[model samples]
Target: MSNELPTVALVRLLEGARYEVMPTASVVDAVGEHVPPSVTVTVTAAPGKGLEATLSTATTLARAGWPVVPHLAARMLTGRGELQEVVARLAEAGVTAAFVPGGDADPPAGDYDCALDLLRDLATMEHPFTQVGITGYPESHPTIDDDVTVQAMWDKRAYATHIVSNMTFDAEHLGTWCERVRRRRVELPLLVGVPGPVERTKLLGMATKIGVGESLRFLRKQKSVFARIAAPGFSSDRFVSRVAALSANPALGIAGLHVFTFNQVGVVETWRQGMLARAREERVHPTGRGGHQDG
Candidate 1:
C-alpha cells in the first residue's frame, strides 16, 4: 500500500460505522435526525438511569430500523432470569450486537459482579446476539491496574467477539496497547475509540459525570486531551491521524472505529462526512493487496 493508504483505510473504516450514544432524555431525538438507518449506534448503560433505560433505548432504535448495540453492564443483571429477559427483548427487536462491560456502579446492582461472569452466563443462554464486545483500556483503567486488565482481556477472549477500547487521546498509548495484545495472543479485532467534535464544556462535564476515570486522568497526563478540551470544540483529525499512522499494519487487526458521540450526533455526522469528502479529494488510494501501509 502507498503512504496514503492508512488515511484512506481509516476513512473506509469510518464509513457507515458505529457511534455510541448515552440514553439520556434527549438522546433519541438528537440521534433521530442525524443517524441513518444503516449505521449502528450503541446505547450506553448509565448508572444513574439504570440498565433498563439503556436496553429500552437500544430496542427502540433497533425497531426504528437502525442497527443498535446496547451496553449490557454486568452489574445491572440480577440473575439468569433478567439476562434471559434482556436477551429475549433484543431478539424481539432483531438487535444482533451488544457491548458488555463491568459497570461503575458502587456495590453492583445484583448477582453479577464483573463482565466475565456475565459473559459466562450469556454463553450459556440462548440469545440472538452474535457479536458481543468487551471493553479494553489503552491508557490503563483508572480503577484497575494494567496487569489485571491484560489478564482479564485474555480471559474474556473466548467470550468476546471484539474489543472496543475506552476513549483516549493518546495515540501512542493505543499503539503500545495493541502491540501488547498481539504479544499476548488475544486475537479479537479492535475498534479504536475516538470522540467526535463536541463542545468543550459539555464534553468535560459529561466525561466527568459518566465516571470515565481515564478521561480525567488522561487529561492531566496527556496534554492532547486538554488541548482539544480547551478548544471551542473537539476535532478528531489530529487524534485519528496519529492513531491511524501508528496502526497502519493490517496485522494489528483494527477492524474499524468506535466514536464516542456522547449524544453529539449532529456534529459528529457532519465531521465524519467532511473527513470522508476530504479523503476522496486527496485521492488516498490503497492497493488491494497491502491495504495497510507498513507500520
Candidate 2:
C-alpha cells in the first residue's frame, strides 16, 4: 500500500470518472463546459420532470460525443411498452448504458414497483444497452432495511453489470460493506459515490428533495445526520482521502469513483482539475505541504 493514498485515488478517479447530471436543460451547457468527453456522464430522473427530461438530456449529451448513462426509474415507466420505447429512444440516441433505480415515487406509474422488477422486464427486451447499473446502499437505506438492500443487490446480480453505491461519508463503512458483499459472493464491480465540490447551502436544499433527503431523515431518526450537515463548509476532500485507502486492496473490486456533482459541474470540475494538478506537484515534491483544495 502506498503511504500517500489520495495520489493513487486521483488516478483511479480520473480514469473513467463519472459525473452525474440532472434533467435541467441548462445542464447540457454546464456539463459541456466543465466535464470532459472522456469521462462518463449520467443523467438523473425526477418524478416531477418525468423520464423524458432525463432521456432528452442524456440524448443531447450522447449526441455531443459524450458517453451518457440515463437513469431508468422503475416508478416512472407506464409498462413494458414504455420500457421498449425508452430502450428504442436510448438506442437511437446512442446511449449504451443505463442505471436502474427503484426511485422515490410513492405510487408507481407502472407494474414495475422496484428496480429488480424493471430489470426482469429489461432482460426480455432486445435492447442495445450493453451496460446496466444498479443502485447500492452502503449505509442503511432510507426506506429499505439493510438486509433487504443486500438481498436486492444479490437479486439484481444477474442483470446488473455494476453497482453504484449511494452517498456515504464514512470510508470504513464503505470498505466493510464491500468486504461483506464479496463474502456474499456477489463480485460485481462497485462504483462508490463521491460528492464533488458542491456548496453546503445548495446541498441541504437539494439533498432534502432527492433520495438523499430520505436517507437524511433516516439518519436523523438515528440521531447522527444533523451534526454533519449542520457544520458550515462541506467538501469531498476528507471523504475521498479516506476512501483512497480502499484502493490498496484490489480484491474489493472498487471500479471507480462516481461523482455526484448535483449539477454543480463548474465547481466540481475546478476542484477535480486542482486536485489533479496537486497530485502531479506532490509526485515531484513529495515533502511539500499538501492541504485539501476543493473549490
Candidate 3:
C-alpha cells in the first residue's frame, strides 16, 4: 500500500486547482467560500463589454487573495496604449499569468487580430509573464481552418509558456492531438480543458444565451455530425476519469486539468474533492496498472 501511494497518491494533491469563472453573480463570495484558499481562480470577460470588465474582475479577485489570471482577449485590446495599460493594471494587482485568445469580437478594435499578434506585441513591450497560456484546439475550431490554427499555434509557441486545450470531449482525440503537438515540437506543457460540474439545464441555458445553440443548429443543417453538438454542454465524470488515466506518465507533459467552471465554482469544487478522496482511497489499497479500473 505504501508503494501503491505513489501511483494513486497524486490524486489527492490538488492544492492549487485552477478554475475559470465568468464575471457574473457574486464571484468573490463564491471564491472565498467554495474555492480552496490555495487554488488559483481566473475570471474571464470577453469582447462585447470590453477590457474594463476583465480588469474589474481581475482586480476584485486579486484583492480576494486568489492568484488571478485574467484572459487578455486580443481583439478587445484597442491599441498598443490600451494593451500597455492593461498590462500595467494587471501588474499592479499582482497578476502573473494571462491566457491570450483571439476573442470572438466582430470588427477588431486594434491592429491585433489574433493571439499571436498580441503575444508579439506583449513581447515587444517586454512585459513577459511568469506564465503565458495560449489556446490549443484538439477538436476543430468552428471558425478557423485547421491548417491555419495549427500553424498559428506553432508560431505562438515561443511566446507562450503552456498550451491550454480548448474544450474536448473525446479522450482518444485528446490523446491523438497531444501526440500531434509533440510531433510538431510544440513543447509547451498542456492543461487539458473541460467544462466543470455544470448542470444540464444550466449548460443549455448558457449555450442558448451565448448563441452556441444557433451555431449548432446551423451545423445540423449541414451534416449529421452535428448530432453530437446538439447535446447541451456539461462536464462528464467519464471524461475526467479518462484524463486522470494519464497521471502517471511524465512523458505526457500534462500540467493539470483546467476546468471552465462557467461560474459553477461550488459544484466543481465538491466534485474535485470527491475525486481526490476516491483516488486517495485507491492509493491505500493497490489499484491495477494505470488505475484504469479505479477510474
lDDT of 3 by residue, 1-295 (tens): 1232333425633434588876654677877889876787776755544677678987888877888888998887787888998888888887888999888766788888888888998988856379999989887887788778788889999999998887777878888888788888888888888766666555555444434544354233323223343455423555666766554454566667788776768888997887677666666675566552333
Candidate 1 lDDT score at position 210: 48
Model 3 gets an lDDT of 0.71
Q: How much does each candidate deviate from the true structure in C-alpha RMSD?
A: 4.8, 3.9, 4.4
TM-scores of the candidates are 0.86, 0.87, 0.85
Q: Look at candidate 1 and tell me the lDDT of residue 99.
A: 91
lDDT of 2 by residue, 220-269 (tens): 54333344543554446666756665765777888788888768888888
Error of 2 at 131 (Å): 1.2
Models sorted by TM-score, best on top: 2, 1, 3
Candidate 1: the clashing residue pairs are none
Which has the higher TM-score value, candidate number 2 or candidate number 3?
2
Residue 203 lDDT, candidate 1, scale 0-100 = 67
Residue 265 of model 2 has an lDDT of 88
Tens digits of per-residue lDDT for model 1 on 91-121? 9999999899998767787888999999999
* Residue 282 in candidate 3, Cα distance off native in Å: 0.9
Off by over 4 Å in 2: 1-6, 204-235, 288-295
Q: Among all windows of ten consecutive residues in candidate 3, which has the lowest summed lDDT? A: 218-227
